[model samples]
Target: MDKQTMLSDEELVKNFIAGNVTCIDVLIDRHKAKVFSYIMMCVKQQELAEDIFQEAFIRVIKTLKKGRYSDSGKFSSWVMRIAHNLIIDHYRKQKNQVMVSNDNYEFDLFNSARFSDKSVEEKLVHDQILSEVGMLVKMLPDNQREVVEMRHYKGLSFKEIAEETNVSINTALGRMRYALMNLRRMMEERNLSLTLS
Candidate 1:
């Protein structure tokens, strides 16, 4: 292996911090496939995964440029964290998301997956609703948020979510249920309506 290739991720990060911008490129080139695979695993859509992959790198670049890149974790893990959040955020921003009523939201499992025939006006309104939903999801309690993100955004089965969370399947289901309930309450309390048509 070349000397640059032999450098560890932290070392590359340090080199980039020391003004060797190309080291960041090496870091990205080395980790792109694994990051893309993880994003694809979460989103189940190649195009969305690719967009998240690019966004993750853009975030990395911005952080490094601001000299805020921390060396405490594996660079791959750091990048994956960014990619994972972006996937979940994208999930919340998709069309036909959950809609809040008086104290709860109505859901259509199929709507979350299919694109609606939205016009410019409706699409803009829908985008605004998605942004609101994404914000509310970010406000959820940690465990509840994790479960909801994995089950809905990551597209994990309840069993898979349980295994990943190191919990029983029932616990995972309960967390997801509570998360949705919490999101519903949040939207109503904030007076955000999903029927923006």
Candidate 2:
């Protein structure tokens, strides 16, 4: 057991900031499994996950080198958050590319109807409602948007959202609550009707 391996995360971060570069190697080695697993789980593609994982660590290294790292003593959580954000960014970029390449870019919540047995009219109504909701979700504040997307789209429970986001369960719930409120207000302001009437 090397001494650096046994050091606390904060201690390792401090040492790294003080010019002991090997401490960062130790830190990365210690947390890589958890961080990489998280990225892989979100992305579900080995190549994409690997890229985001590397980018997350690169951002960490840059932040640390710039003396911008605040010692919160939760380095693992910080790294996980970075990886999560990177995964979100990757999806957003992919979506933008799709929209750009497709001349008739319609938002299809259900990409395929393989499992659904709905008539064309019903499907169109459902798709329109989902598209409106998606636009409203995008307009929400980042934290609120994250909570809503995780809970509804990703089907994660509040506890899971809290764990993944490094926030308290109550905080996650609060974000969801506020997100709903904001979405309702936005819908009313826009006179958006999500009904099939």
Check candidate 2 and list the clashing pairs. none
Candidate with maximal lDDT = 2
Per-residue alpha-carbon lDDT of model 2 for 1-197, expressed as tens digits?
A: 39999899998999999999999999999998789878867877778878998999999999999999887659999999889998889899897886423345687555566535788998899999999999999999999999998877655679999999999999999999999999999999999987777
Q: What tens-digit string does per-residue lDDT give for candidate 1 at 30-135? A: 9986897788877777677778889999999999889998788788988889988888788788744755344444664445424556678888998898788888
**RMSD to native, candidate 2:** 12.3
The TM-score, computed over Cα atoms with residue i paired to residue i, of candidate 2 is 0.52
Q: Residue 165 deviation, candidate 1, in Å?
A: 37
Error of 2 at 36 (Å): 0.6
Worst 10 residues of 1 by lDDT: 100-109
User: Among all windows of ten consecutive residues in candidate 2, which has the lowest summed lDDT?
Assistant: 99-108
**Model 1: clashing residue pairs?**
none
